[model samples]
Every structure is written in C-alpha cells, then in structure tokens.
Target: MYRFSFFVALISYSTAINAQQIELRLHGCQTKSDKTYFCQLSNLGPIAIPAIEYNVTLAEDGRTFPWAEHRSGQEIAGGLEPGETMDLAIQLPTLPLRANEENVSISVELLPQYLPPPRPPADAPATAKTFANQVEACFNRSTLSSAAANGAIDVNVTGLKIQKVKNYVTDDAAAEQLFQAARRAILVCMSRNGTADVDVSLRFDGSGVHGLPSDY
Candidate 1:
C-alpha cells in the first residue's frame, strides 16, 4: 500500500511539472514594402498550443502610431505541436516616411490548448515584485561574470509594468544573451504564479530594470 501511494504521488508531481512547462520562441520578423510584417513562431515545449495572439506597435520619440492587431486560432490548422513552427503576417496602416524598422516592436502571447489542473489553496499568490525578484536572481545566476562585470542589471516591479535595460554593453551578443535570460526567467515566474499578462518596456539609459502598472 505504501509503495503504491508513493508511486501515485510521483506521477502526479511529474504531470504537474509537464503541464506547466510551455515555451514559445519567436524565430525572426521582417517588414515588407506593403506595410505588412511577417514573423515565425515555434513551439519549444512538450505540450501543444492551440493558438497565439500578438500585438505590433510602431512608435517614435515616445509617440505610438496606429497599428493593426491580430487574434486568431485558424492560423494553426490543428495546433502548434512540439518543435513545430508557424508563420504570422500582420498588416499595418501606412507609416510616415520617417518611420523605420527601429520603430517597430512586437509582443506575443500564447494561448494554451488545454487548461492545467487547478492549484491547491496552499499555493502562494503571484505578485509583480516577486516575479521581478525571480527574474533578477535567475539572470544573475545564469549570466557569466565577464559578461555582467561592466554593466549593472537591476529588476524592479510595480503593479504590472516591467522595465529592462540595454545599450550599456558594447557586445551585442552579450546584450542579447542578457535579454533572453531575463525573458526566460519572466516566463517561468509568470507560469508558476499564473500571471496572464504584463507590460514590458526597454530602456536605453543602461541604468536598470523598473516596473509599473498597465491598464490591462
């Protein structure tokens, strides 16, 4: 009886872990002359995702221009399977001649195909501060000493706003590495805390990370 109980407990734990593991990667994005941008998304997790919702923003000098948003499940025939990739194309309004590639930013949100089992009441509630702390800690632990030696990386949290820093390091590869590391840490922390959405900003000052609240 004791052996059977232990086996069942282990299986349950494993299932929970698998259910919470979801990873989606944005391979690349490019703009076309027709005011449309195309991007490739890949499912890097064990589970399949039903669909994706994404927002594309065009901004310059802290001003945002009108842009189109898309939300659809029909893009994926059945679902996005593990190691599978799908293409996304979004149309935008005509932009001012001054608008350039640097003004474009894309944010993506994945929709799970199935809901995971409910968490027990004992589970701690998710908070933005906690999430930010987790991200900072994870990034620090994952980054190399040489890469982080010259610049300081800080993560701060407010209501729902999150800030990330860049432009301090001269090494493009190292900067990208830090950005990816912070992104992965945020994803994991959000998953554990059941955080649905967050607003992320990138700052060029090279100071540190900060968070604020969003209307969403």
Candidate 2:
C-alpha cells in the first residue's frame, strides 16, 4: 500500500495549508498630495493572496472619518501577492483642511466581507517608504512584455521600502526575469530620488519552480 500511504500524506498536507491563515499588515499613514492620506500594506506570510479589502479612518482632535462605510461603499482592489506591498489612499471631504493639522493619525480597519485574514506576526516589522508609481509602471511593463506569450498576467507590486524591494507574480521565472528589469527601473528612478543600492525580495506560488526559490 505504498501508493495509498503517499496519497494519504498528500491529503493531509493540503488540509494543513488550507487551514493556514493569510497574513496581512497595515503600515502607518503619511500625508500624500495636498491633504490626502496614503499608506502601505503587505502580505508577510508564505502564501500569495488576493487583494486586501479594507476601510480607513482618520483620528484627530476627537473626530473620525470612515472611508468604506461612509464613502465609496463598494470595494475595488486586486490583492497583494506573497511579499508584495499594496498602496492605499484614504479619501475624505474634510482632509484638505484637516491634513494641515499636526499629529493626525489614520486607522485602516479590514472588513469581514473579503473574509479579511489575520495580521502578520506581532514581531513582524512595518515600513512606510514606497515606490508605488514605479511598481505600477514596472508591473505594467512586465505584463506587456509577457502579453505576447502569456496574455495579461495579473499581479501587484508593493513594499519598496528603501533598500528593500519585493513583489509577486504568477510566473516566477518570467516575473523574476521581468522584475529584474523592474529593478533596473528602480535604480534609475531611485537615483533620481537621491537613493541607491536597494536590495530586492521576490516570491511566487506553488512549491516554487524547480530550482527556483522565492527570494532573489
């Protein structure tokens, strides 16, 4: 019954992963543009998950503003890949006036609708530095490059904290190769921003490709 035992072990392993929790993290909010709030969130665990569904709030002077509950009731997001960081913006009518005030704090709460998963480990660190624009551009370019063969690959890039770069793609080999191109883009883009030598982290789905680990 060697084959029967192997099949039993396989089922047990599948059960374990499905029972595993999807990890998430919400970084701090920083003032972006003129009175707008922006933040970064990441998938810190071993699995590549879908877009995060969240609601945001601004707290200061004893007042709070909720983004999803009160504004834009519906959700629209493409989820963060394993080790990928997703950039989010909080919208509010009074932000233009309130943003000027110092010590403003933002709170982003995840809703149950997306069956939002538990957060990252308590000891897991958080970062705020981002290359959202560059990420969007790079993903777009990579998708375009892969289009001829793989059609439009869906992915999101986040967590570009200085000296720490990471992203996730459907195809590790193609994405790793394509995102290396993204790394060069970051080099040029960051150089203009007065930074250099940012290390990168990449992850993919499955037990990973043969001879291809998640990090590079």
Candidate 3:
C-alpha cells in the first residue's frame, strides 16, 4: 500500500511539472477599430506545438468605467515548435468602452500540443520570391496586353480623348524609357496648368489651373 501511494504521488508531481511547462506571453496588443482589437501573441518556448487554446479576459469596474463587451479568439496558423514562436494576430470583436472608464488588465492562457522537433532555419533560404514575378509580369508586354485584353485594367472614358500606351519594360533601358514618357506627360500638363492656356487643367496633386483664353 505504501509503494502504490508513492507511485501516485510521483505521477501527480510529474503532471504538475509538465502542465506548467508550457509558457504563455503576450507580445503586444493594438486597438484596430472601435469594435476590433488586434492582439499579438507569441509562443516563446523551444517546442513545436500543433495547436493552442487560449483565453483573454479584461478587468471590470476600474474608476467606474462603463461595461465594455469583448469577444476573443485565436487566429493561429499551423503550430509552433520549440525555439520558434508563433505570432497570432487576433482580431477581437468588441464594443468600445466609454472614455474615462476604468483601466483594464487583460489575461491570456495558452495550451500547447506537443509535436515533432522543428527543422533548422539554415536549410531554408530567404529570397525575394515575389519581386521577380512582379517584374516579369510588368515587363512582359504580352502579359500586359493579355491582361488588358481580359479587361483587367478597365477604363471608362467619356469625353476626353483616350490613349492606351503599352510599353514593355524588361530591361533597364526600357524602364528608363517608360519613366521618361511619364515625366514628359507630367511636364506638359504642368506647363499647361501654370500658363492657364487650357480651359481646365486638373493636376491631381491638389493643384488646379484656370487658363484664361487670352493668356495663351
């Protein structure tokens, strides 16, 4: 009977140790909108966990502040292993607490699911993955033409004369050409606006031009 009791006590101790082993920390929190708060949570342990269940509660009745309703949840993607942290950008949907209300303390709890060890970061190469594709799409006239052909960049022109220029910018030379063309158009518009020669020159940088008929 003594031996059995000793075994049960050992098991209880082990369970307590493991239960509190998982660490929980709040990275930061930001108010997104009157109704939403973006709470960022980070796991600062050296274990890759499959899932975590967390809860957050705010303090009530500080300085007689109005009661604010809060809803909390997680926006977790996959799991985090040891030495790797997970950033959960949670969007809390809640009604805004009135001003001059009580200061509130938020509480968070995390439950982690143990998984296999994490892979070394040295094996993963960080490169500009999207820039090349974006550049290629921008420079490929065929792609741009196809996109225009598909009405991706639709323009609804009514009164003004419309011109569609398809400039392929693959190399630096072509890019320079595109920039020059854009600059030339801007300069022409600026000259027209400054001299007031045109009836109406709308420079969209918060500038308006009223050209007199005799000024030109």
Candidate 4:
C-alpha cells in the first residue's frame, strides 16, 4: 500500500508540473445596436499563449443563451505575451430575447501551441527615403534590365513603389520578371538593414505609382 501511494503522489506531482495556468479578466464591454460587442481580453500567465478560445453567453430573464464562440491568434501580429491584452469584437446572433451589458458572461480557454521564436533586437531608425535609396541600389545591381536602374522610388511605412523613368522593357512578361527580381532585392535589403517588411509595387511605365499618399 505504501508503494502504491508513493507512485500516485509521483504521478500527481508530474501532472501539476505540466499543467498550464491561465487567467482571463474582462475590463470593459460595449454593446452596439446591431448586437455586436467590443471587449477586452487579457493574458495573465507566465508564458505566451498562441490562441484564445472563448464562449460568450447571455443570461436574461433567468434563461441562458449562447452568444458567440470564437478562436483568435493571428489577429495579433505576434502571439499574446504575458500581461498583454487585445481588443475583441464579438457579434451575437439575433434572438427573440433581449440582452444587455449586465447579462453577458464569457469563459475563455488558452491553447498551449508552440511559442513564437525570439526576434533579434531592432536596428537603428532610418528615414523612409534612405531605406528607399538602398533598395533601389540593390535592385539596380541585381537586375539585368537597364530600365530598372535610376527608377524613382517612393517608400512608406507599409509599402514601396518604384517607377522607371523610361519604359525600356515594354513586354508585360518581362516587366513582371523585373518586378519579381526587384522584390527579391528588396527582401535582401530589408534583411541586411534589419528594416521592417513592406509591400513592393513596380511600374515599368514612366508614370508614378499611385495609391500611396505623398504625405507619408
């Protein structure tokens, strides 16, 4: 009997060691006229959590009805780390009964998926024009198209656009090839300089690339 009890205790200890502890606290919630609620979800744990699964219910008139069941992870650029919080927009299905803020209840479960890899320290800040010039130089050296050289560059926080001064390569397929090459060059430049990622668009025609604002 003593041996059996020792084994049971060992098993219990192991289980406790492997168990994941998580907490969910709601800060504030707002209900819209269309049965949508904006709420806050917080992660109160020692480690990062990749995904959050939650069920929201409405308790009204002594009866409970399921409002929403949602799983979110990728909404956040990186996984939700310890002590981090995210905004959640939850919509409820229309029902004959009416529910208000006081009647809502939520239960959250944390999924222990793989943790995100550690990121390198950020590089020193540089102006958008400087980054754009570096990318243009890299593209000019990497591509075979002469028209790609000395292209006008526009860079913003989210996007980069390059327009050739002269359309030397008129073929659509050849222009696309140049664009692909330019894309690779931009990626390499970003890695070398430790710059943030941005979308790249190429214009073979002399016209400037549209859609990006000049004020940026």
Predicted structure with the largest TM-score when compared to the true one: 1
Q: Give the per-residue lDDT of model 4 (tens digit) for 87-167.
A: 866654443344454554443333323222222123323353355556655554434433333222222334444433222
Please provide, for model 3 over 1-216, each residue's C-alpha lDDT reduced to its tens digit, 9 standing for 90 to 100: 000000000100012113323444555555544333444444555444444444444444444542333333333466554456445654432424453223443444443322222121232111212221222222323322211211111011112331222222212333344334333443453344442222221111001111111111
Model 3 whole-model lDDT (C-alpha atoms): 0.31
**Candidate 3 residue 124 C-alpha distance from true site, Å:** 40
205 in model 1: Cα distance from truth in Å? Answer: 46
Pairs of residues at least 3 apart in sequence or in different chains that clash in candidate 2 = 50-79, 51-79, 85-158
Model 2's number of clashes is 3
lDDT of 2 by residue, 1-216 (tens): 000000000000112114434556666556655345566666666655543344445445545542212232233366456688777675633544434335444455643212222222233112112443433333334343321122112122233542313322323454455445444555565556653433333222221111112132
lDDT of 1 by residue, 152-214 (tens): 333332335444432333335544565555556666666666663644332211223333222
In model 1, the worst 10-residue window by lDDT is 1-10
The TM-score, computed over Cα atoms with residue i paired to residue i, of candidate 1 is 0.36
Clashes of each: 1, 3, 10, 0
Candidate 1 yields a Cα-based lDDT of 0.44
The C-alpha lDDT values of all candidates are 0.44, 0.38, 0.31, 0.43
The TM-score values for the models, in the order shown, are 0.36, 0.34, 0.33, 0.34
Whichever of 3 and 4 has more lDDT, that candidate is 4
Stretches of candidate 3 above 4 Å error?
1-20, 61-75, 96-105, 111-216
